[model samples]
Target: MPLPNILRYLHREQRFLAVFVVGAALVAGFVKLAGEMQEGDTQALDIAILKALRLPEDPSQLIGPSWLHSAATDLTALGGVTVLTLVSILAVAFLLLLGRFRQALFTAIATGGGAMLSTFLKGLFARPRPEVVPHLVEVTSMSFPSGHSLNSAIIYLTIAVMISRSFEDRKSRIFTITVAALLVLAIGCTRVILGVHFPSDVLGGWTLGAAWALGVGLLAATLQRKHKIEEPDGSIADQSSGPAPDQIGS
Candidate 1:
């Protein structure tokens, strides 16, 4: 079967395509808008405000590096990309152990596909890192969309979705969501606190990440509903009244 046909079949029963197309278009439009933005003076004003707010500029100033390193390592271990790798491996391991090939296949596709989309989008944006001030921590990459923040959203949120499958308590769900959110927020904030990313860079990254992840998530939900990949739940629904202050970062 052709690729489009397969994607349609993968999500055949729902409005995945409509949402993906529209979400992707919006992301593209925002990327263009960010690129066209020439508000350096505005950013300068914000930077002055940031200093006035007495926010710590360096990660070490906010938290010591040795301690922050351990924290980053801890989070890194639990971070999205890491979880994706671990899950893929374990899923394969489980498939081998239990002969659950279908379980392995679908989980791999949803998780793996999301990771790939995140990578592709990162490369496409390739925004340079901020040079407004000397970086507080070492970094080297295009900085338009923060890879850590974007990937954290995809990875953390994906793992949380899978974990919610077995848990049934309200507290359990809330905890999982909180942990995932804090991880994303922390990773993004680390970028700015480390002085590697401007506040706007992080904002653009969060916007793109949110739209991308939500689009993928909604697609995943629609597919699960149509394909019956897993047990049904009131999935991928949101109750937010407005854009999350995801940039509650820098």
Candidate 2:
């Protein structure tokens, strides 16, 4: 093989290895956190964090300005089912319009599958909602793993990964992913501040959600390498004289 080709192959393999290792580590961390929660080892820490977020005089009120509370409520809704579903639908429609059928299909699957997984985990644990503080928002589900945190992380991160592919520069890709991460962080924090979830619940959701997104990314990369999926916009295939796979149906 040519030296340049071999070097490219090595670089690709190294990237795949790094993603796999990070995904595996995230899964392991989630497992450990889950086990600790089951053993009641995280209760004290979770309770303390939840309580600290509330005012000493009134557990019902969050320790911030009135506007901050209102802002948190609105931000938290971004992670709700209604908003996420609408966002997912719009994203898939956009991808389809771009003739990226496989990308749209996978995005739907990733977000939908993540939601189902979140529900299943919540049911499996049957953890009660925090009673140490009054909840600012209404909730009526099990709470070992926060649904908002998990769903938002999965949806936003998956979308970010897909969108980043359209950018040619590393800085643009990093910025996109960073924005998604910040959104996820903000949503998770709001859940705690509103007294809807234990801190450990958000932590569990983040680990698992990130692992799921990484797993999907690995699959997408593998399929792209095998010529089974559309390559990114700026890939070598897009530079060729022939039409790209994603542009076939356009």
Candidate 3:
């Protein structure tokens, strides 16, 4: 088949089509956001949002009760290295046990690639963390793209998409994807609320992270179409009909 026809067929799938549109928007938005941040155009907005969580009397302290602080801290940890790593490992292990080695590898690559990309972008911008309010958590890195926010989005969304693809029902796929999106958003919001990241930093992280996941997903879909990567029932298909011969469809 022609490349265009293949793409058209892929686009006809509602999920992949929605992801492509969202992914393109995110990439473009990330570029524009990075440019504006570089020029220091977002200082006022950042400060305003950062300070919104603080009391009027003491700018250094957060306005919420003590429990809220603890809650934010706990929620933000969901995006931390330890938590994300554990989730990824468990997911990869489950897939491996299911004999879905290709899917497992792709999941690892998408997450690992997102982390590397986030680090590179942070260094490229070399933006500092917010000093307008006292940070609730320790951080030691350039802060244009929030590592937590980026990695959380990358890890959760990538895993969600992978798992959702295994299901044969539309509602199940949508539910899983929606939950992942909410978790990603909550994690990003906690970073900003805790005064560790500016709103723009979180925004940039989300944009790039989501785009990266979707890009990887589309690649996997393409491979699946070409029979290089197997579908959800590939294992059963293999058992019943021997291994599928690798071939590109016309």
Candidate 4:
């Protein structure tokens, strides 16, 4: 093979190695956190963070301005089940309209599986909602790993990875993934601010959700490479310029 081709192969191998390492680290971190929670070792830190987000004079009020409170509430709703479901449906429909049936199916399966995994983890831990501070939002479910944080991270990150596959440039792909990550962070923070979950819960959700998204993306890329699944059509962008679509993973 040519020198350029060998260099390209090495770069691809490095990128895959980096992604696999990150996913593995995230899984390990989540497992450690979960173990600490079970041992009641994280309760002190969780209480401290929750209290610090609230006023000493009034635990009911958050530390920030009233407008920030309202904004958090609105932003947090984006992670709710109804909104996520609608977004998933729209994404699937859009892909189907473009004749990307396999991609649509993959997206559907990823999102659905993530949701089920979130529910299963919550039930398995059976952790209760935070009571260190009064909850600003009404919640009635177990909360070791925040549902909102986990679900939003999975859905948004998965979609972002899929969408980024259409972009042939490194900058565009990085920007797309960065935006999705920020949105996921914002949603997770809102859960803590609203006093509905411990800080650890949000952390666990983020780590596991990110790991799940990365895992599924790697799987899809492997399947595509083996000719078992179709590559994205790159219909979202003009591919007349920039690098080849296969240079980036799905």
Candidate 5:
């Protein structure tokens, strides 16, 4: 689909849509810019930024008391597979309670779809990870599509949307989505901060992941509408919300 149509679909709220469109456009620009540049010094700006902000480089140091970093690490870590699986199960369970079997099934399909797209794009771009600084983390996958960034964003954001329709208060609905966004952002940055992914990789991951998630989400919503499924507006995050496919319909 054209970018304009995609933007229209995502534009449920003008302000948020503006941010998303702008972010995607800017990231796309940078991805292009990054593609043109040869191996150059990246550490100078980073060093200056780090010094100006007085942020610590060590994981332990970054995790002083916010506990969010620690949580983010757990979500983004390779060991996070178990967590992701568990979350997916929770999402399905919620769908089951809401009598949304179709969506429960969609969860699996959507995540796989996102992964496939990420792989395809990574191969298409063939972007290399930055070599200016030493890699503090280990990664073997193609670098253009950050797996960690895409997965978490798809999963968390999907849950957020599912819960949004059920809650009348709006705050309850918004909180779940807010946390989901935080998880996506935190995990993406963690990939960069850990020296495992280039900014472009994370950018591409979010763009591609959100696209897949949104497509699936629309499909799910369409199915729900056609079938007249009335799902309970329960808090999705409090339970086992996992992959976004669960959030697709009903």
Candidate 6:
């Protein structure tokens, strides 16, 4: 199958460039946003958004239909510890079954590292959860950066990038990334709507999460380039024409 010319070119010539530009941008954004949050610059915006989700007379009561609240709760769960853990385990198991041990290790490191990073940031910030509106869901963690939003982006986006490398078709790669992005966006929104996090919290999470995920991907790509880790099926190997005949490449 013919890949999009630009996408293929990017994979071959600009992998490092792409990761650097995107990762740097995300890190910069996260820093700027965190500073604003610390200075209380985001207070007005956060309050406005939180209020918008609730009824005018009673901030404790959500504005949406009953079903929406339930749906948001379900979606938010997708980013929770239990759900994400199961996903990581299943993915790693599948990779191992295919004998892609190195890829499996990379997946474990990316997901585990992201979780640790989230916990550390939460402790460092120790920002309180929103009080303007009654929380639709119970939460006890620090709230500057929503853990659900951050972890969801890190896990889903990293998995998407890894899986996309196995496909030679540009459309397939784009679709995978797009889907991951949408899921991250939806989960972040749900946290805000549930009144468990502030807008700036979600923003901070996404910014840092994107940076972390892309950074891991860059490392994996570097290892693949050096033949230190196994490349996914159809990935360019030393710019070879294709995998060795009957090699069943990882």
Q: Could you give the candidate ranking by lDDT, starting with the highest?
A: 4, 2, 6, 3, 5, 1
Q: What C-alpha lDDT values do all the predictions have?
A: 0.57, 0.86, 0.83, 0.86, 0.58, 0.85
- lDDT of model 5, residue 188: 83
Cα-based RMSD of the predictions, in order?
12.1, 4.3, 4.1, 4.7, 9.6, 4.7
lDDT tens readout by residue for model 1, 1-250:
5566566556644455776776787688656646654445336753653343233564234344456644654554453455657755774565445443443455566567766766675577676666555565567667656667766666566556544433458688679767877777877766665566666666665666556555655654544444434433322223264323331110
In candidate 3, stretches whose alpha carbon ends up further than 4 angstroms from where it belongs are 1-18, 236-250
Clash count for candidate 3 is 0
Q: Model 6 segments beyond 4 Å from truth?
A: 1-11, 234-250
Pick the lDDT winner. Answer: 4
- At residue 49, candidate 1 shows an lDDT of 32
Summed backbone clashes in each candidate are: 2, 0, 0, 0, 9, 0
List candidate 5 stretches off by more than 4 Å: 1-75, 78-82, 166-169, 228-250
What digit string (tens of lDDT, one per residue) describes model 3 on residues 28-60? 999999899888898899999998899878876
Q: What TM-score does structure 5 among the candidates reach?
A: 0.62
Off by over 4 Å in 4: 232-250
Give me the overall lDDT of model 3.
0.83
Every model's TM-score = 0.60, 0.91, 0.87, 0.90, 0.62, 0.87
Model 4: per-residue Cα lDDT at residue 122: 96
Poorest stretch of ten by lDDT in candidate 3? 241-250
Error of 4 at 160 (Å): 0.6
The better-scoring model by lDDT among 1 and 6 is 6
What does candidate 5's lDDT look like per residue over 134-201, in tens digits?
A: 45456676666677877776766766666554566768877987877777887787776555666656
**Model 4 Cα lDDT, one tens digit per residue, 29-64:** 999999999999999999999999989999998897
